[model samples]
Target: MSLNPSPLPDSDFTASGRRVLEVETRALQALHDRIGPDFAAACRLLLGCTGRVVCTGMGKSGHIATKIAATLASTGTPAFFLHPGEASHGDLGMVTDADVVLALSNSGESDEILTIVPALKRQGNPLVAMTGRPQSSLARLADVHLDVSVPAEACPLGLAPTSSTTASLALGDALAVALLEARGFTAEDFARSHPAGSLGRRLLLHIRDVMHTGEDVPVVAADVSTAAALLEMSRKRLGMTAVVDGDGKLCGVFTDGDLRRALDDEDTDLHATPISALMGRNPKTIGAEALAVEAAHLMEEHKISALVVVDDQRRVIGALNIHDLLRARVV
Candidate 1:
């Protein structure tokens, strides 16, 4: 075989890519149209399984099976991939009576998968088969068969698993999503499983988790001098200070912007002016339990850099700024 093959024309490359896409698109459409009673039956079997759904296959089918298992596991279903070749070598012990077996094979006669079918049947595990051939042995033994037969292979030689694998993957995603909806899986539920992902940070992180509490919160009495409020802001490094009444209820907020404006006023005395006189009243506030993403939205909407976290009584319990959110990776 030549290590350096002649490159095809750009037009040829583009045409070939489009042809493959068209073939796979048609295959997916057929799979979609075929969804009816059997698809629902497969979903029902998976939903009712008391234990995990064990996905098994070989070669290209095995890669699709692994992806399907991951999708199912992440979307509120407990699932894992079991390689068929490994199953006969004592890995069959992983399957239990309660597990639901999802087997994948385009021809539906993969020897490794068939070898484990009898053991699965003896254990009373429900079998769901995804295959291109309905009359094949694995499909015949399946309690529910999902037909993923494509009209043709996307490969020019019709030897590679192209359209068939695409169809199978789409069918697997359909099954996982149907089960996800049936289980009423929410973003928060998904976030819990993907705690390190961006969605998890946005959904699971709360203001309380990132806010500065106690003495770290910049707060000043409403009657304090503007200089005193500036000191509080400087100490907390939050760019603003919450001005509260004698009862510790939030009266207003004094920020760096407010100070810059105060500096422009010739009559204003920073040392003598009370913070209440310089503060901006009815400032934006958030509850400590609100999602950190909500705080980011609030800040953006109000065009402010920080927020005072308050309770029902409007007492300042915490404070946070844009930098805080950035540090927490919630922004």
Candidate 2:
């Protein structure tokens, strides 16, 4: 058996980390001050797109392109990332005339991407180039150009794309957000695009969307035996069952915890008692149209998992528990 360790560094890792931060921060500031007509024109071009915005790049530019695509998709612009190498390899078929292509390149002359320009043009898709070298071939060939040039590289060798890539990422964020505002994109719209996200499911899902309805609801007659009500609750597996009166209107709810408290009564007659005798009157009722997340908050506030969904007449129409919220990703 053997254990080997590399020699310790002469410099502290913390100091190196701080240096990287300082470099990136400077890069961002440079990008912020560099915004001009090109940036605005880029947003305008994307805002005018009638179809999907396709992002493409090579190497490090690909990483930035992927992130930019996500931001655009979440912000209201329909977008996706395409790999330059893959596109040249036949994946280019995914692009169409209705789409706009956003190409990223630090040198503005990546060969893998340059190979696809002719195909993109033949398809009549407009090109918006993001590059540090505005005078390079890709930028010159573009219908719109965004300059993400930086003053210097953070890399000590002045070769690795450190500051330059940071600038590109920041510029991409600026462009996405600008287009988002121009399109009147909202948080709710963003949520709709990201339905599985916490904010999306919370704001977009309703009680009726997740509540157990139809035959899945657990209900008991107002006079049903404690044992019978408990059986219904157990059968439904929602931890609670609504107790309704002769009018078919909700009168109370019986929960597992409530049953536990009732069992503690020395005189409790479980076999002979009606559910109404141990039910919670005027139980919290949620409307079908109410947001499921709202129901979650109400449940948290009241310290209850399940609630009866009722109509204006208080007739139980549905039932939901915290488990439902968890399933819906709204918890």
Candidate 3:
């Protein structure tokens, strides 16, 4: 056989893709309509579970189960995926009495899942069954059954599990979200579960975590010369320096932009002109406790690249630039 196969006409390919999407979309609509008392019961079982939600399934359903478990876990509900096949062997030990078991099976008769249903019952774990067949064995035995039956499969031959799997995944998402809302889950709660993700960095990272402090902060006395402030900026490599009064409180800020303006005036002497003469008074500042993403927004709003981190007294405690945010991966 040749490795390269003849391709179908572009129109034919697009028609087939559209057909599949239409079938899945219809399936999702049916699933949405079917959400009622049964769905509520399933959510109640999961929410009442004191331990963790253990999702189990076989084959294509298993993949969907894994994703559902992850969604639930990241949204304030503690959950994990367990392979039904493995559970029949020994992984069943992972499911405790306090855990709620969510089993997915299109036909609701997967042998791997069926074999463990009796053990789950004996362990006193609540079982929530999601299946395309309401009268199937697994559904009948479940404490709560969620009907995910679809009108048809997306495959032309109706042999693939496309529509059924899509409906199951959507239903799982609905359950997770319902539980999340019931538990009053917040973005901060979600971020805790995803600390390594971009959302986590945006929500959890504060200015204190990324700003340059103490010696690393570029600072100069308000009475210092423009040339002296330039030296401080170069030494700190922050492209800006905070100008403070004798009491060490922030009075103004002198940046590269200021130097440019000062140089434009031939009458201004870099060495003799005090920074206070050219610095921006009441410059934009942020508290160290503020979110780092807030700093990014403040900089964008002002069309500036750096900000001075200040205290209640407007003392320059730290400084940060766009580069610092980039290095921290918060930008």
Candidate 4:
């Protein structure tokens, strides 16, 4: 046995890549041009759905179906993917009268999918078929048939599911996005579906949710000595302390950097100097109800590591440091 290694010319590689893209682009364009009453009907079915969109397919179509299901689920439509083979076995129980079944098959003649069609019909679930063959059995039985026909496959042999699959996937996306618009799904709704994601943290996690409250907040009275403020900063371990007036309204903030700048003056009296003298007046503060990302942005803009969380009255209610955002994964 022997191996011959021959690297293709860069031009050949680039040309091949370009050809594949052009073919897929044309397939999508065909789908876009064909969108009409059927696509609108599919969107209406999804929008009117009282239950989940159960997507099923076979082979390469199955992979595309899973992604379409995910897109639908995240965009405010409750949806899930079911394997056609599994549905034939016992997973058909997952379908209900209120559910909508989205079947995908480029050939529209998948045996696995066809095996489960009667049950889905008997269950009275609305079926939306995405197939390249509008006259196929699956399309004939469908309540709404979305044509995903393509001129040719990107594969050199024209056998593999290339252009056809791309067209089907694009149609799936069109359905999901159309339903999303009709349903008025917003980014906040998307964030709710993705609670563990970064967008969720930015949208849902408020400063108060992650900031140190009550005794955990480092604070020093306006008249407190610099030495006392340093002690408060140390005990809180936040590298900063809020300087507040008698009413607890935020007057200023004192940080380790402030202390260092004060110390640079050889004649400065660290022990007897009032913290208010060394504190930064009108320090940046964020409301407790503001998003945590706002605090992170403030810190970045001011080149500081912490921010004072205040109430509507500008009274200190909490304090947050860069570490707090890190620990909460809000940053």
Give lDDT per model, in order: 0.96, 0.90, 0.94, 0.91
Q: For model 1, where is the 10-residue window of minimal lDDT?
A: 1-10
Top-lDDT candidate index? 1
Model 3, 95-178: lDDT tens digits are 889999999999999999999999999989999999999999999999999999999999999998999999999998999899
Write model 1 residue lDDT over 94-210, tens digit each, in one string: 988999999999999999999999999999999999999999999999999999999999999999999999999999999999999999999999999999998899999999999
**Of the pair 1 and 2, which is ahead by lDDT?**
1
Q: Which residue pairs show collisions in model 4?
A: none
The C-alpha RMSD of each candidate to the native structure, in angstroms, is: 1.4, 4.2, 1.5, 2.2
| lDDT (10s digit) by residue, model 2, range 110-178 | 998899999999889999999988899999989998888877788878988998888888888888889
In model 3, which runs have C-alpha deviations exceeding 4 angstroms?
Answer: 1-4
lDDT of 4: 0.91
TM-score, one value per model: 0.96, 0.78, 0.96, 0.91
- What candidate 4 gets wrong by more than 4 Å, as runs, is 1-4
Sorted on TM-score, highest at the top, how do the candidates line up?
A: 1, 3, 4, 2
Superposed on all Cα atoms, model 1 deviates from the true structure by an RMSD in Å of 1.4
How much is the lDDT of residue 104 in candidate 4?
97
lDDT of 1 at 80: 98
lDDT for predicted candidate 2 compared with the true structure: 0.90
Q: Tell me the TM-score of model 2.
A: 0.78
For model 2 the local lDDT of residue 286 reads: 95
- After best superposition, candidate 3 residue 183: deviation in angstroms? 1.5
